[model samples]
Target: MDEIVVGIDVGTTKVCTLVGRVEEDNSIRIIGVGIEPSEGIKKGAIVDLGAAAQAIANSVERAEHTSGVEITSALVSLASANVASVNSRGKVGVSGGIVDDYDVIRALEDARTIAIPGDRELIHVIQRGFVVDGQDGVRAPIGMHGYRLEVEAHIITALAASVENLRQSVASAGVEVAQFVLNPLASAEVVLTETDRQMGCVVCDIGGGTTDLAIYVDGDVWHTMVLAVGGNHVTTDIAHGLRLPIAQAEEIKKQYGHAIRAEVGLEEYFTIRPFGEDEPVQINRQELAHIIEARVEEIFSLTLQEIKRSGYDGLLPAGMILTGGTSALPGIRKLASKVMGMPVRTAKPENLVGLVDRLDSPAYSTSVGLLHWALSMSAQDLAPPRRRRMKGESNMNLDAIKNFFKRLLP
Candidate 1:
């Protein structure tokens, strides 16, 4: 039997779950998937515990049915607006000629020793690169002669209360939390390649209530940020601009909104019923597209400003890859390309079995990436035990290592 792992994406607009099995060759087979309308979340933060738990339960149940497997735990994506990241460096000395895994742990511990005030928790530690002795960019230093080992990493942090609340909500759904993967990092795993990162690329995940941005350079994440504005804001702008009910406005935006007005004809019109009016009113499609285009321009402008602030403007040879639900808006790529002055394309999850057709859309990238991430982590966890048995060494204590890393934070 294949070992199964589950991935849960809790977003402001939706909650999605994916079940995947790890193959012998380390590839992932997506066996089940589920999505449900989200409640109790605003701008990616859980506002009401009860509502969020119910949403998680609903999605998890659907995924279990589709996969025909029981899921007790999941690796979740963390995309709360409160999350932030900082870069840090650390160095350690290797006692023996060989650089073992323990030396790697010590280096990471040194990097995480920076002072952080109360109410913040370490979220993720991204390994940027390693320097062995005087040589840099060494991917692995194990079994190599090196007295000094240096590591540069980005330590992501988030509000402790918010994380605790999310954990409680998931536990309420009766699921064990295996790990939390950064949302944009997960998106990058599915959409970006080494060459794209080396050439500098920005991944914009335009979710329901938040837009998560991750800038990559030289095959490493340079910066990460989350904007509290997203598709929900567009819906609000349309509803307020068009004098329609919120539900009706969302329906109109989904069905008719376009991000570029130049492609729409001036005489093309659509009808929408006002909140109180019984008869539907006809409006020019260009007018609607113009409104949407304005908001989209503002979004891309802000995103450009963020990239500029990172000092990566004119450096991104690969330009940008847009994903998430908002990217599905018609002509969004054109609008983004025009405003950002760079090549823009939509990103989708690429590899999957049984659901390749369904997972081809950009909106499902994060969910699919989460599945891949869970499987990768599981494989890493299982490697040491198998290695020890082959080498006739004592059974390696994996749980101890996990606990050590966990305790290094708080």
Candidate 2:
């Protein structure tokens, strides 16, 4: 029997719900997709519970109707400026002079003992790498002979209140939040290749309200962050610059937006009627590009700043992989490379089968990645339990150990 999985991506500009089936070859077939305009969400946080709930409900209903499956629990995408990450090391003595899965879990559990604030909630505890005894860079320690084991972990957290609000909104839609995957991490699942992870790369997901980032090195996450500014800011700038309504400004931006001013032809122009103007006025496309360029530059500048702040800016030899809605903007890859002084490429879901007519853009990377994550989690459940004793001694379970190894592996 094929296993079914669902992912609900609650983004700033839209909410996408995807239902996929795990085929025999482990390929994901997109069986259902629901895309709806987001309401009551700003910068990835819920501002109005009722509006957000209705929007999620509508998206879920559409997916259910298309796939003939009732949605229950789903892996949800999350992004907010309140999200933060930290790196720490965990250590544990090998129980039987061999570093087993149990020992690895204990090490990760030790890593999770950070002093987080009361207002924040822990989301992910990803093992970056492991060390056996004093030897560093041990990728898999299970069955290795060692007296001591250490694991380096990257921990992500978010504001408790914001998470609860978003949770309540999904709950209202009758869907349980199985896990909250950060936006850039989800996007990285779809866009980043094995080489990108083994080398260094940054996943930049520019959505409507939030710009999410994740830095990877040695096939593990090193750092992550979410910026409050995104494409909506560019649209807002155009609206104010042209004295037009937000809707009109958004339309024009989509139709004529460019991240580089020099790339736009000076003779090209578009017509739009601003407030208090009876007739439509011809607006220079260069002017619109100018407005967009300023905002897009600032966005990358901020991203670069954050990358530098994380101290991993120099490690990214693969540069950046750009995704999300705003990444579809014309000339964005060149502009991003120019501003960040690094190679950049735009990516989206590829090699998709079944109901994938609309999932071919960079905008749906996170939506599709959630299905991959769900599949991995399902695999973790089928992993064989360790045969050794010590059943009640450890606080962590066998499933948690398998999951930790899943994250630890490339």
In terms of TM-score, which candidate is strongest?
A: 2
List the candidates' TM-scores in order. 0.91, 0.95
Per-residue CA lDDT of model 2 for 33-111, tens digit only, reads 9999999999999999999999999999999999999999999999999999999899988978877676776788799
lDDT of 1 by residue, 27-100 (tens): 88878888898989999899999999999999989889999988888988888779988888879998775666
Model 2 poorest ten-residue lDDT run: 401-410
- The alpha-carbon lDDT assigned to residue 297 of candidate 1 equals 89
Q: Stretches of candidate 2 above 4 Å error? A: 382-410
Candidate 2 C-alpha error for residue 154, in Å: 0.3
- Candidate 1 deviant stretches above 4 angstroms: 356-358, 382-410
Q: What is the lDDT of residue 89 in candidate 1?
A: 83
What TM-score does candidate 1 get on C-alpha atoms?
A: 0.91
